[model samples]
Target chain A: MDNIAGTKSSLTWAVHISVAALVFLWLFPTLGLFVSSFRTADQIATGGWWKSMFPSQQNLTLRASPASEQKLEGSLYVIEGELFEEGIEVEISRWGASSQNISTYAAGEVGEFRSGETVTVQANGSYRIESETEISGSRGKRIFVTAITPPEFTFENYQNVLFDESNREGMAKAFFNTLTVTIPATVLPILIAAFAAYALAWMDFPGRSLLIAAVVALLVVPLQLALIPLLSLHNDITTFLNGLLGLEGANELKGKGYVGVWFAHIGFGLPLAIYLLRNYMVGLPRDIIENARVDGATDFQIFVKIILPLSFPALASFAIFQFLWTWNDLLVSLVFLIDSTGETTVMTKQIVELLGTRGGNWEILATSAFVSIAVPLLVFFAMQRYLVRGLLAGSVK
Target chain B: MHPAFLGLFTILVGVSVCVGYYYFSNQLLDKVLFPAKGPNAGRNINRREMIRPWLFLMPAIFALGLYLAYPVVKTLLLSLSERLPGGASQFVGFDNYTKLFADEKFWEALQNNMLWLLVVPAACTAFGLLIAQLTDRISWGSIAKSLIFMPMAISFVGAAVIWKLVYDARPIDQDQIGVLNALYLLFGGQEPQTWLTIPLANSFFLMLVLIWIQTGFAMVILSAALRGIPEETIEAAIVDGANPFQVFFKIKMPQIAGTIVVVWTTITIVVLKVFDIVFAMTNGQWQTQVLANYMYFQLFTAGDWGVGSASAMIIMLLVTPILVWNVYNARKEMR
Candidate 1:
């Protein structure tokens, strides 16, 4: 449209800049979490994630080798050691022996301790403490350094959050539990809604339009309204079945498990599932169905053989939608699947619990959150076309 | 058995059962109950056609009815009656509603929800439209749109964690870890603020998380609507000396107004039932309670089913107009 008149608009740069700003504004929060996940606990605590890309100045309290490591050389008893551990490269700009004046001495300058020991610390973190008398304490002497540490990132947080076995807050079990809930929940709804959508679209029946309208109305029905009644219903059914079957105690259905959550997801997902599939199915070329009907193919056969295959895009669309929805859902899983035992917790619930317990522990929180978010994000970016297609089909005319 | 194994087993069984139900029921209609090879073949074929649609629909209907339709009525009834001691309920007309009305917390939640209703949808839609229009002519528009739309996949809890890092606070003496506080201090603020603990502003901060997630949705829908606008109409507008802004505001905007309404109401419905974000972020602390969280608190924490169901009904009531509007549109589209 801008090129139609052979005149370039001056606002083109504005358009680019505004879109860039909008995209940056949208991406910044998730980026912060993603960056924080890789940072160590001390790094996250002392600085913002935005500052993590550059080398940061940090105030560190280091200890020289313990007084027990002191060695007598001629007339002087000397304690010598590196303040930082092996392989850590930091440049100490200033050094001090006391807490009150941490930067009193520059690196490579000697500062006297309260015990009349003189300590000279190098920028490479090697320090020498010399005294005329023997150092007697078992613990190392305290040294404070103002060091400029290089930019550092680590996979240790991910290792601890996902791979560490002894960590009680590990997300490994919860990751599997999320898969357990998500697969059945996503698959069952598509099957059930597919058949229903086929019938609503192709099979001639009284009140077909009404059924479609009902599905449309149900699409916006908040799943919040379903929580209490369905929970009670599940419990009642379990009790009734247990009584009839003469089952009791631990063997009895607790009414909250994978099966209950699956059903809840199916129920919640069906309206949009049916609505999307039926809309797509209705738009399928009309003569194809008529041709199949004339060729002595049953409605079931036609739907299974022709319609299902032809509706691949629509099916893929709904599958991605349902997959993301079920995988990321917290409320339904919390109310239905996870009980007081907390054994069956999904990642989202686990992350929320971590939020409460480990609020200040951003390494754990960010790593755990990113672990849960990783799959959906992959599915989102990989099949975003279908997701957008599904959204447009589901929402817009 | 392990839950993952159980899940795999359930998927196999559920799929086979649905497929088997459709297949066996169709076979029963054809072979046994209404045999097409019989002397009454023609009549049997007609009868089977009449029943097959219902057979195809039966499982979906049962599931939907049990899960959704029945719950709406059940919740409505539970709202009017209080629970008794022994799994029984006594009829108490409007007692729950009255009790809920008298609670200050309920009023706070309702007021905050009203604020959310007023702010979230408008901000999302406006931002969505702006992004959609802005990204339309750019070279990397699709990539920009996809990045913007990426948050739609993140769960509310995940988003809460993300934004929590953004709003994290530290003491005045320490370096601020949260971006908001860091920027606050950088921009000449005296002290870092605990963004989520402040009264009125905290709600908006929470709403920012939602807006961040939902604007993606609104953008995707409205972007499609923008592309759907007729090219000739835009060209005609431009030919008539309509500047770029005028073309978008006067021409393109009018064309996609219906879609904007759809996106708005769709987001409104989402906002109405937004529980996880509030529950995860503040858990109704610091005056950030919304309706869904309030209902969950009533039902689970307080063990007040009557008021919980009442609050659920309030959400349903708010949704009813959109529901009716949608159904009406569907019916009209069918005609």
Candidate 2:
């Protein structure tokens, strides 16, 4: 029985090992993204992120001097630069004008050139040109320099992605734009919803059931159905009412209209917001509101003095969800917030264009992506304690 | 028009939350907002009490009405029209609906959507279940959970970029540089494949990206549900000599049916309007058009407002029954 049990334990261990391997296979791609963000585009293009830790020796070509200037002094036309210093072994390999046939010679190998020139490269970053005469050309000579690059990492990509003025359309602006939309977008819905939720959850009203049903029904309606018709309606409304508000025509307000997008954000955010907030507000201890009501507290006073204070966890958690959802939104912002020209492009759109232009360049993408996600991450982490507790509150109760 | 909207708007006149932040010290709310552990509850119900909540709610309602409600009405109207060039259309009742039935691309899109609705949610749930089970066995369970959950945090647009690299194809003769093609060659395939060009194969390939992203979402929710299962029930099942698989299938799963439905429906709703991934990845090209992408092309790209609105209405109508079911479930969970 002991031997049989031991064999079963080993089998269980084997099963566990295979499962662990599957998990790693699943996770490596995103992990590669995080790792690749810190690497050069060239490096990422050449090999996997696993190889980045090791030092790599790469051969590079440098144009040092002109071929015609070679006087053939001492049976050699010497063109030299500070490419190699003492104690630094700079090596040269194959050389060609066409990048297609770049790898023709081995480092430290002698070659007889078609120009009647004999060339040999050295390991110590020096080469000997034992040519009968120098080749002729007005343009500088084509020389290949191979160097061993030490393991390197830089914050330059992150800085460029995040802080460069050219990147003003970057995370900084998007961060602020996100805040502009998110703060009001979140705060407004809760303010409205809290009152409605309070009414639905606590206070009595004639149309209360109808309103609750409406919001719940609204929750089922996906936002994608609203995108185009919404934009044209916005244009029409602005046109119809631009006369009333002393505002420019609908097309003129164009991409700069935060009014349209702010409305869009709030609309999409409402039903769920009201539902979530109501669920939370409804769950608050009834005794507190009842006691407050007995102490001359009207419905308004009860909401203010008792219910709102107790509903902190729910409010905070909802805010985090609203902020993250609105911040990461591409579709709503693209249709509503984006201008006729590309001027008002948000960070998410900027990152998207960067993907189109610099698709293979992981450094630019990863750095920008990290920037785009930084706020959401920070919001999630900061209010995370409230988040799960809030959204999940109504479920268990 | 809600009483909540009216009451708050009336009371908050002149005095506002934004204004209160600056001069709230002398006011009642400074004391009321922080009652007891705060200041004592100030004056109970006063003039500001009536309008305060609605004061806050008014901007939100106005915004919701203008952006959300108006478009819904407008789309309903546009769905009946024969759209002209200058945003004008002749009202054509139900002809758009007639065209909707006859269009092959519409049916193809509808079929593909059903395929997504079937394939993606089923695949996502399976992967989520697998990961949840395997990770539950691991020592560093949260680490595994976090790794899967990490994808959930990225915007759909960001995931598209990560996938573009994974699906990137080069000439078959040159080099199989894409990860999938490279794997195929490594497995001794004769020629590199254009994974995107193969219609059914590409659909499955695109589905993988959606599956990749959503598996994490499913796992987190399901993991939470799994955690909610009572330990004693499992112990009881084990004592009955039920196998581990039996314990999972019969014992643990039946307990969390509601949570499973919630996660599945939520992903279903998300999959219905999936635009960014399909748009960014394939731009809905080569038999890749889903409803949301097709709606976008019809409306914005082709400027066919009537058909677009009708399609939007159709998507909304399709999602409605599922949503009603979900709301019913939610109410059940609530009660």
Candidate 3:
């Protein structure tokens, strides 16, 4: 078969080439964000992220040594110092003393400034200025240089987004808020749905098939319909219960916080969880359950001891799905959790706010977005086996 | 209370309650309500079996009904009534629907959603099939497939930021920072065009983000289907002198047609509910409104619950056919 057609080799090459191309096309967007997150605001705005890997030529405004550092050398007052900070990888390609002609002279060349000072700037940003007369200015001379700096990346953006205490828009609280929303929202649904799935799968009841059909139908019900009605219902129930019990903070407890959001996620996530787990459970071997039954174990014991343990793959798959969905959810949190106090804002909402206020601030936007995405990406790649298995099971029935 | 501690406490409470309820309910049903050692033991066990399923199903049914089912009906009712202050409402049948029908933004959203429905699914499916077929025979196909599938992990807002950088534009006579505009400049374009400001084309640009994320899903499913196309059929076609293209379109594709429909419908559902991308990227500005964003704008910003519920009903209306189709398929499969 291999020898039948030499054209197969060329076809194989084409396959390899096309796959590589497609992979690059897919990875480019994510890679752009990943690369830009480490960059400074100046770097990100001056050039595209793809160009961040190379030495970037930039017009820099730097100050020379002030008059205090000027030494009397022979008859002239001279100032000698390096323009760039220590250990910075910068090559002064072109240098000038004025804004109009910033690249007036090449590296290692000397020119006369407007003050009649002869200046020489070397490629490594070392410069010497010799004045004909006494230099009396208190401020240092301004030197504009067009330099090719080595590709630079900084953690300052991440620091500002995550750890800056004074920054009102920091993602620290939102990160914790997202964690609070996600953990219970993820855990409760699996706990609740696993039981129902077992009943639908193993236990016999009337309308079992119909229940399965309903779960499948509920899978695509848009959450948009749930927003207004649920909000009103929640508010009314909270207020009535508060008045009934004569409690002070019942309204605060029930109004757009963690518990309400937890319930919202559990409810919204139940359909897919049940659907996935039931599909997986129905495929489990009947012999195990029958053996447990014959041994006089009750349905609860069988579910807890035998079915739950054996359904790990399915359970793990659904847990990952629910976790990612709950973590990434914005509309749900916006409607159900975030009150006027804004204390319950999640990372998605935080990023949206940043998109509005700091639209041009890629440093903040990129870092905040990366922070939000990093956790799910870790969960995704770490448990990709279960994730893919879940996708295959959930969709390709 | 600190949120972290509250989180830990809630997990404990939630798990314990769920586990405790199932354990206790089952025990009560067996040991108290239907004692197996009674004189009518056989009948008691039979009765217990009939009741056990409902006990197991109670929590799930309650949650789903409260969260999903009731909302569907409540939304329908709310669509017909206008909300008054202080937890009261007056029935105003057909008023909300009439107002919604008259609004131009709703029409724009509907039209744009139609466009999204058409483009996103088709592009995702086609690219998915192309990648699937190409990668099926390659040695490094799995790696390529995973790379493409990686976008599924990203949130739509994160993806918006990623693509906002790509669609970024700069004024003429300045160095372009966005890759799209940079390429445009490099390839002899006159001025830097704001890719997201252009009305009709901007919607397509946003659709590209979803298409990029979803094609991997389509590929994963379609690739599995392609592999399942029995080896005998492909070998037989090749031996009969059908070329590669003919073998694909004439033989292999027809077998995977059912899967193609499934992928298309799945992505179509996703496209119909597309909100976060449009919200984060443009917020439906410059004629880019979709139903979900428009509904959000109505409900929250404009404070019009009646019209908001109507738009939500429209979304539900769009989803009804798919819901029926999915249920029909499930029932058919069960039979």
Top candidate by lDDT? 1
TM-score, candidate 1, first chain: 0.91
- lDDT against true structure, model 2: 0.68
TM-score of each: 0.95, 0.80, 0.96
* TM-score of decoy 2: 0.80
In candidate 1, position A28 carries an lDDT of: 96
For all predictions, the C-alpha RMSD in Å is 2.2, 6.9, 1.9
Please give the CA lDDT of all the candidate structures.
0.92, 0.68, 0.91
Candidate 3, residues B1-335, lDDT tens digits: the string is 89989999999999999999998999999999999986999999999999999999999999999999999999999999998997589999999999999999999999999999999999999999999999887778888888898889899999999999899888887778789999998999999999999999999999999999899889988998898899888778878887778888999899999999889989989998899999999999999999999999999999999999999999999999989999999889888
CAPRI quality of model 3:
medium
| Candidate 2 or 1, higher TM-score | 1
The interface root mean square deviation of candidate 3 comes to: 1.4
- List, in order, the clash count of every candidate structure: 0, 10, 0
Candidate 2 local lDDT, B69-132, one digit each (tens): 6667778888898877766679999988887778777777788888999998888888887778
TM-score-sorted candidate list, best first:
3, 1, 2
Ranking by lDDT: 1, 3, 2
Q: Write candidate 1's Cα lDDT for A243-292 as tens digits.
A: 99999888988889888999999999999999999999999999999999
Q: Identify the CAPRI category of the predicted complex in candidate 2.
A: acceptable
